[model samples]
Target: MPSTPEVNFFQEYWIDAWQRSILTLDVLRERGNAYVERSARTAPHVLSFAFEVVRDGRTLPRPVNYALVRIVPPQGTAIDSAKPPFVVVDPRAGHGPGIGGMKQESEVGVAVAAGHACYFIGFLSQPVPGQTIEDVCAAEAAFIEEVAGRHREAQGKPVIVANCQAGWQIMMMAAIRPDIVGPILLAGSPLSYWAGVRGRNPMRYLGGMLGGTWLTALAGDMGNGTFDGANLVANFESLNPANTYWEKPYQLYSKVDTEASRFLDFETWWGHPVLLNAGEMQWIADNLFVGNKLTSGEIRTSSGVRVDLRNIRSPIIVLCSWGDNITPPQQALGWITDLYGHEDEIVANGQTIVYTLHQTIGHLGIFVSGKIASREHAEFASCMEMIDLVPPGLYEAVIEEVNEGTERPDLVHGKYLMTLEARTLDNIRALGVNSDEDNQRFATVARVSEINQGLYRTIVQPAVQASASDRSAEMLREFHPNRLRFASFSDQNPLMGPVKGLAEQVRANRQPVSPDNPLLSLERAASAWISTCWEGYRQVRDAATEAIFLGTYGSPLLQSMVGLGTHHAPTERRVARDLIREADEAQLRIQLQQRFEVGGLPQAVLRALVYVRMVQRSVDERSFAMLQAIRDMQPLNDRMSLPELKACLKEQFLLLRLDEERAVRAIPRLLPESEAARRAGFEALLEMLGARGALPDEAARRLARVESLFGMNAQPAKVAHA
Candidate 1:
């Protein structure tokens, strides 16, 4: 009785489905086991690298749970001790640290492969009792100092990788102690709290809808002084109802053969819940999320010192994605607009700010995705020094994949080419900015939050604090849906005890159905329909949430009650200018003009390169790489170190900014006296200019200007290269 083809397909689909059900449960059991195992450890993290503890923030003068650890490179990989070290500061929003180094294709891996020393900042499962965000920031400052001290022979200070929440944390540290850090990479971090388009980015509207952070305070109190991290993780999941509620589990059943391990790996991190102090959560809620105070210069340290973002001299590189509902491009880049009214303001402050926007990627994917690790993070590592030496200005970091036919592929590193093109504040605004009414509504939300928090303290605090006990808080945390979901199916549970054996038997006799199976096709269609339904619901929910928030917050009566009436205009909160800084910059500009006749061939070449950049609109790493190669050919003693080059470039750029014509007119003064020296420099300029394929008309014309300045009529720089 052999079965027909139709019967065979039908039977295959059902058998695979039956096996997948058991296998998916087994995968869940593994995730639960991982969660249970991690819970027993002192400082459990998801870092993919093996590292040794270096310094503990808990041991510092101001104790916190954070600690610094050096990532041990994989076997046979050699790290150059002289190169700038990389320190990745993990975000403690919910999950444990080590996220940036969670796989071989990650920030830490790229840094190691690029021959740089690497370190990571990780926190423990529980926050230090009574620990404030200030304490954490100060402790991180100590960690940076410790890392810097350990790498004294390094070319530059440690480049800090500030992931998500750690981005603002590192920014505050750099503001207070700007000298210790090198360049900073702000990966998916949000500085602007209230920047979002209407009908989208509904997360920002939650505070207003809920009448402020009173619920945050309530959660803290209910935790008996220890806020559970699961709550934050739950909010992240709620953003994507389809993925979180349906698709995630369904995908396991549909592709259990290949997706099980990945599912378990991700769930291992996502399921691990940590704890934060009640006061710490409240501080973040008040100061960062709802208050929108970081870039506004409204935050002050415990010692009453103002934390101004402009005080941060280190280069800030912001990496954000448009698809990230949590930290959209607006929140990631809007801080620049909030802090600086014009592009010249950033330049005047002597700050280098670079941002890169991905077309699509979720918030976690910014650090967790393998493609991001290999491309965006890789390009940043390859050109760390190049970015470090760029002049103080706002620029956009553009990374292009190196196609097979890419021009000047020799100049590129790995699979991508990195470039920094000058940009303006208008570029950021084009990403999607909130209107005046939107900002007004957010302001009213902040005011309403204050009012509600006051009322909560007066009315709700006594009852919650009195009834909450340490034992009950522990039980409450254990029962959180995030934890219960895992624990309920864990190996510890008697009901799931047979899943492991059944999954093993299924794997030993696997019978995956063909992709062409009709029943399987119908199943996929059903799944797609369910996902579509969930997506529709999410859109409607977000729309309703936005409408309610706007209607309530935009109400004149409510606004007046909260003290945000029509009299108050809606603009992003701005940092007040320091007149003293302005005067100092003015004097510096004068000093720069006087030094126009400084240095020899190197200075001449640098000025020419800056001229090329000024004239040509679109540029890439080809020219920058050529500059270093030309420098390398010079006498060992004559070659300037990276730090010295940074200083020179900054001077030349600022000088040109002050008066371009005057600066160009002064280039001849910096040229050498010897004919051979001048010729060598001129030839170097031609080489750098010709590094990219054939020079376009604008570039050729720009090179001709340099030629007139250099007094050379040698071979045309228009020489083309395939």
Candidate 2:
């Protein structure tokens, strides 16, 4: 009794359903083949761009697993030798390298498109024998030096882009060898390991739940001398089981025709795991993860040099996301709290730290999303020069898109304007959910870690090492769950042989269901329900884990056993030594006095301008660009280098902070005696301040000071026309 159209629709739906089943099986076979092929390759970098090796670590006395490669740009894009070279260091956490340049719209790609030479630091699957993290650091430093030597005519030091784990390693390099590196960009890196909110971040309590670094050592011992990276990969997957187990596969299955290439491309890198030496694994767990000593300036190298973050003089740009549970904004920005008590201390230490927060991007999205690459990474690359020119202080780098038909045009080639606004320590602290009770709990964990590590080394380490063997280690790595999952479905399995032939036949007579089909809609709804069920399970599991962790670690008896009192005390703040503080202040005071009356018209004008900016606490690309234009004009042209000009600006700023009244009064002494020169300087300062919009309150005060020093009346001159 059904109509003709209804009968035809049912027939088409059945045919489409049969085709989709066959297609899904084929896609799976192809994915298995790709995995097997990738696993068989040696030294697989997985970079979308072609590269040539520049330096090999195997040539060194204490060789590492890494190598430096120069990227070969595609057609229509050529490297400019005059621009600063960019070096991207991908995280070697659990996967092989090249995530930074895995796609066309990535960090390395953006840098290359901007006409800069690109380089990538990657490693092999196996680490060199007896190679420690310190050795790896040294190798990276040597590689950077080699890159610098090749580009002697470049404008500045090499700009380093480090992601996640590489972020902390690069910071350590910058602290030890600040002279070789330029501005460093840290994306999704957690410098402060113990920082997190109570209910939101469950990973922070992982160490406390396991009792200490003993479990890490036990895992390493079981692996015979190298830790299996598959285990680390499994731990990361456990954080988002819904995505790992349900949504990821279901999405691929629903759109198998379109999603095959993307899925395989990502899986190639995800499936290939690497290894870490036992010593390197143990050091990271003890010193950085459980011990929490890097920011506190307690970590030391083999050569007896203290690894203090204050030693790094390069400008640091921290890029994090609110949705990144792995490395939240608190973990990314909490190092400021650990190093300095107040914002003034950062300025006094001569550090320039700029941070930007993405609203809802996830951890991997921060580095791999093409949309993020074209916007945030593009804006960052365009503003590196201006970032270096900013005065020593804490700032928040704000990037906003340019609206259509707006008078305020894009400063760079992109549609975004990057602004650096001064911020205080309070602003940084507001990014975290800081609780005194939480701090004491983490401090208690640190003490327990020390005691446990000592006990393990004395009693447990010897027996484990004596029992471990190379054959058993290889067997353990081979049988890891992550590896077995891939191997189980690959072409090596005899059962998959018929799947390939059936998939080929389905592709030859393909029939895809219409997106609006009723059956297809029902299928998608069913998939969604499955995903939701997995998510609910994950939430319940996480809540129970957190409750258990707090109950076991927060016990009074356990606290006392670890030498912590029944009522735990907050950790003591670390401050700079008095001798260093006094010495730095003395040097700054001497420079301020010496340069108080130095220079002619140009120098006087710049000194006044810098003082105004210091008071207003706002600096952006538009203002700095205007300043550059003014610098290119007569009298200031070719007079001083950028370094010298930056030095002058810093001296004036320090002088203003030391004594504002005296510094403002001395402005006239540096200016020319002629009234015409004084008026012209005042007009230039006003122009720079009003470039963006209306003057802020501090800028108004500064404008009044400038007018008073020039002996102008209460009614200011018409500088807007100038």
> Using TM-score as the measure, which candidate wins?
1
Put down candidate 2 lDDT per residue, 1-722, tens digits, no spaces. Answer: 76687667677778887776777766766666766776677687679998999999888877998999999998899787867789999998889888999999999999999888989999998888899988988999998999999988776789899999999999998888988998899999988988877677788888887778888888898888888888779878888888999888877777888988888778778887899998898899888887778888888889998888887877899999999988989889999888888888788878889999999999988988899899888888878867877778899998987776533464334678888989988997787755665656666777787788789889998999899999989888878888877776777888877887888888888878777777777878888898899888988888887788777766678768777665556565353454765598678777777766676666667767777666557777777767666666746455555556666677777777878777778877887788877777777777666666566566667767777877666558443321
Taken over the whole model, the C-alpha lDDT of each candidate is 0.87, 0.81
lDDT of 1 by residue, 1-722 (tens): 98899888989999989988888888888888888899999988888899999998888888999999999899999988778999998899988888889899999999999999999999999888888888888888888898899989887988999899899888988888888999999999999989988777999988887889999999999999989999999989999999999999998878888998898878888889889999998999998889999889999988898899988888899999988999999999998988899999898888999899999999999989999988999889878988888888888988877897787889877778887888988999998888888788888888889989999999999999999999999999999999999888888999998898899999999998888999988999999999999999999999999889888888999888877778776655778777888898889877886877777777778878777767554457777788788878878897888788888888888877788888788888888778787878888877877776676666567678888788776655545522
Candidate 2: C-alpha lDDT? 0.81
The window of 10 residues in a row where model 2 has the poorest summed lDDT is 713-722
Error of 2 at 101 (Å): 0.7
- Best-performing candidate as measured by lDDT: 1
* lDDT score, candidate 1: 0.87
- Per-prediction TM-score to the true structure, in the order listed: 0.97, 0.93
Q: For candidate 2, give the lDDT of residue 21.
A: 71
Runs of candidate 1 with Cα error greater than 4 angstroms are 1-7, 713-722
